[model samples]
Target: MAPTDVNRSTAPLSPAPAGGVPGWPTGLTGLGYGGDYNPEQWPQATRLEDVEMMIEAGVNIVSVAIFAWATLEPAEGEYDFDWLDEMMDRLHAAGIRVALATATASPPPWLTARHPEVLPQLADGTVLGQGGRQSYAVTHPLFREYAIRMATVMAERYKDHPALALWHVDNEIGCHVPRDYSDAAASAFRSWLAERYGSIDALNTAWGTAFWSQRYGTFEDVLPPRAAPTYANPTQQLDFDRFSSRALLGYYQDLRDALRAITPAVPITTNFMASSGTKGMDYFDWAGDLDVISNDHYTSAENPDRHIELAFSADLTRGIAGGQPWILMEHSTSAVNWQPRNRTKAPGEMLRNSLAHVARGADSVMFFQWRQSQAGAEKFHSAMVPHAGRESDVWNNTVALGQALKDLAPVKGSTVRSRVALVLDYEAWWASELDSHPTQALRYLDQAQALYKQLWLRGVSTDVVRPGSDLSGYDLVIVPTLYLVSDSGAANVAAVAERGGTVLVTYFSGIVTPEDHVRLGGYPGAFRDLLGIRTEEFYTLQADEQVSVTGTSGDLVGTFGADLWTEKTHLAGAQAVAVYDDGALAGLPAVTRNTVGSGAAWYAATRLDEAGTAALVEAVLADAGLTGEVEAPAGVEVVRRHGSGGASFLFVINHTGTDASVKASGRELLTGAAVSGDLTVAAGAVAVVQEG
Candidate 1:
């Protein structure tokens, strides 16, 4: 198909604003590698130099005009396109594609100055100032109109341009101001609540508004869960979180629809901040609107397990794409500028990091920027071409990785092969960590990532999926700290067990409804029947308290140390796998397993340390009839992307200070090295094997 072809895919995502399955611009081939290209920052002479350098670095595509709204529309109802037109034509002549942004990411000072009403507001009734990015209130009508106008003009201009490969919506929606609490947002929230619950009476019942004399006779009286004297209604807060996420998504859809109306053939997408740092929008709910899923992930220099978090984010993105190939829109080539301590990457860690995402299912790997900015807020942020120019290691490595991606082009469009499904529910995450929870120490991301880290360390490929996604293909489904799950979501988890698959329900799961309503029955209200266990109360351990547990048989050991949380669990029909040997909940079930139809459901009633988690994960896999090393060699991560006709590419990433070997017989695409029995990957390096 050509770049402008309308018939791109036979199976397009429903409601695809782009009219087809979102993919790389129609004609571009090979794996994409580039970053944000801001030509406006450089002089005219530098434009040619950028293209030449891009060619030298093998950059096939660059995200242009992400923050060029001020330059694109200096004044309302006024436009300028000469510079952009010249730059786009120049890039087209150089054989480079563009992910042309709508340039509406940040509103210009003039627009905001004239329409201060469009600025976002905090819950405390304080209006956010201009100066920074993402300052416009997403729900404000005036802001949308102005943003849409800019997008409409961009679409009309570049709809037929040869260099236009993809339409980039406003960059990283809801990154700074996840939700606004201004009067404009309050009106929008009221309208959203009415649409959701239909009537004021229904909203009152769902929100349990009878408490604290909060009942409302009409939806007009409702406001966003803003600052209040006491604790705001939990259900109201949850709904506001939902509404806020939806509002931002609707804003994106507004831009996307305008672009789609003009350029129906071009794929449209906005870079989603899908990592732990971002908790505003549920990308699962936002995925159907995108033609292809694109995510922006930057590992924290503060985290030692940044690579694992990167894998988690990538898997979650693949899950959002329904296991299809997706684009890695933005990541850092080296250290990021935002962190207080922006530590640089260690030698080959860059290549390993990029390929790890690819191994997880990203077909197009790009970074935050092409050139390091000399001015502005992100001047110190690392880029493919740094302030030090093309002679540095960052530049040399950038060129080498580009060629490596070109060499590994065959892996494009393939799906990651994984049998373990990890449920990641943002709604549950939001509700589970609400202010009035039993334990403020119940960190949702920490628990989920820890479980994912175990799988990542074991050389297991895991897909981070949502609650209600189809789980039939998975052999094991792990639900970690899912404190809020709907009836259907709970059923989906049960179906995994009923259909002869293994499941593990961690502590503080299945406790509340979608509306933040507690289940009437025993604890783990949603999964009592499936797991055959009941909990009376959550015995939240003190900060320094510990509980000793014993495993049954050889799997049951001397002392299974547990901390942070313990539950008083009673077995309805499940047999105890581990018992609390000491502490207030002595002799109670710490871990229990039950046979549900042909499958099994295991529940962990308390938190476990790293070693205990590894063992329990091993046991769960054993029950699922799956096997892998519970303790694999340190620092070696393996993942396989499976293509059609039984073709598979094994990615062996060695993250330690020594060389690692993997058993495989094929060609390593990274270095084109032949492998017979053991594939050796150098320290801080990666190997992609086309296995026999």
Candidate 2:
């Protein structure tokens, strides 16, 4: 039977602390379905109906004022809060919480018209047209002033509003283009370079600009490296990336400080676009200012592995906030409107995806819209109530999911305890791509995604940790595509390996240092001795070239692309786990394992395919004595949350279309199910298995 959606009374909500909201709500873990709510857009008479429908579908919170800049401030010197005041009042009356947002993402038409300097310039010196939202540059002084003003106004006005729960900062700050090379941007870039290097000589040394006579005579000569074709210098590009990230941080900090002044009680967050170019914005720096880190995740429904990416994104946010529960600001209820083939989410996919986030440590869940728009860019975007309103199939599905969330409120605030951490570095991502390599097809995200899937299938709790994380407790640490490794990062890995922890280093790792400079002496620099291998020469092959490597022990076979930076290495103290069986450099080491100190480090000399990566991951985990610990069924996902209570709650979610067989050894918290052997779980089933 489809679950009947319940009202706010059953929607278990964690209250704010005595003084303020304590470290963001982490409880009765379930999905909260409502996004981009703008009651101001609809007639006042229609609000009650919307609220009734929302409550029936278990939507406890609404993300309001996403792009209301024009309405909030029609002119430069004036502000209006009449519509917003009424909207909040109506939500309060309906017992619905509000994710109050600063309507500064899209500047008012009048403000942009009056101050065109707020607009960003493209990389090739072309000025960006001011029509779309988030078109302004982060460093623009006028943009900063108006943005801060809007944020301050919202914070002060909603500071005491009982309905205000979470603060949604600027909407998708870097949605559009990346860096600009305008005169203003160039001036700011030069100042940033001056602060970073202190002098032109140091700058030259870092970029190795002397090789191409690109040495700067003065700081003024350094501009945002945006010119295309033959003029793209990777070193300059890296600096521009760092500069843009800092600039975005400044904008975020400005609004964060403003919100802090009035509403110190509620958490503030900005929704980050999950997959995008220009990794300039450091999520760590941005997350540090937020009470809860929120993200806008839209994935292809056709790909079964999309859930893995979603889990990875959630883990990334959790890592940034030190395991604080996060919110999903936008997710398509059925299918995405943006993709060419707008396929509807399968019968059980929506519920499955929602539970997957909970399994990964997501505290709150919401989508892009509650009701569909009649006409706009997102008119066709899937929502709780489609264009067909409450009569739609999507609406029914949404209502059923809401009822499930309300029933699972007892599982909220559960903490996740992970045994494996995959090291994902943005600096390495930038350095690897910025270095002009042989294969343009080598995608860093895809490689990281591949590794994540391997860990997921092995029933290991995994997290995408940053470069400098505490790796003492973890049994296995997987570092994929670690292209740029600083001395400190290398030291951390060494410590982990020396302390009897297994470390897996993949291809394209340890090529460059932190300052965008190539490591001196040998490739993989500080890690060469630890890895027990030295790579002297490297070559690249075509896209179709296959790398066939034979394993030394297990009949495990490995295959990967030989088209990207194929390295020839001599194993010093490491044992050859796999060797290239068929290639010009046949019988050479393609995969090696080195036993250093009390632990071991496995190095994959080439990028492996899905099957190959899984095998390698299984082998690594087995050697570390940490494989298949959590015995779960084929489609049933298992997750554990640990915290101050000294108890762990394992969530077993069956998001499959057919009945799933699930078995556990812990006491079942939701039902009095037996804690032994396998049990059949109905479609869209969720079970909280607790282990004290």
Residue 567's C-alpha lDDT in candidate 2? 66
Cα lDDT tens digits for candidate 2, 202-318: 998888887767877888777677765664677788778777766766667677667876776677778876443336566765565566678777777566667666677777767
Strongest candidate by TM-score: 1
Tell me the TM-score of model 1.
Answer: 0.96
lDDT of 1 by residue, 1-692 (tens): 11111111223234545445446666678888898999989998878899999999899989999999998887777878899999999989989999999999899999889999999999999999899998899788888888888899999988899999998999999899997998878888888888789889899989998889999998888988888987889999999999888888888877887888888888888899888888888889888778778999999988999999898999999998889999999988898989989989989988989999999898899997998999999999999999999789999999999999999998988888678999999999889878977888888987788888888877777888999998889999999999999999999999998989999999888888887888978989999999999999889988989988888743534466889999989999999999988888888999999899899999988888877888888788777877542223677888888888888898888888987776787888877878898777788888888875
Error of 2 at 217 (Å): 1.6
Please give the distance, in angstroms, between residue 11's alpha carbon in candidate 1 and its true position after superposition. 14
The prediction achieving the highest lDDT against the true structure is 1
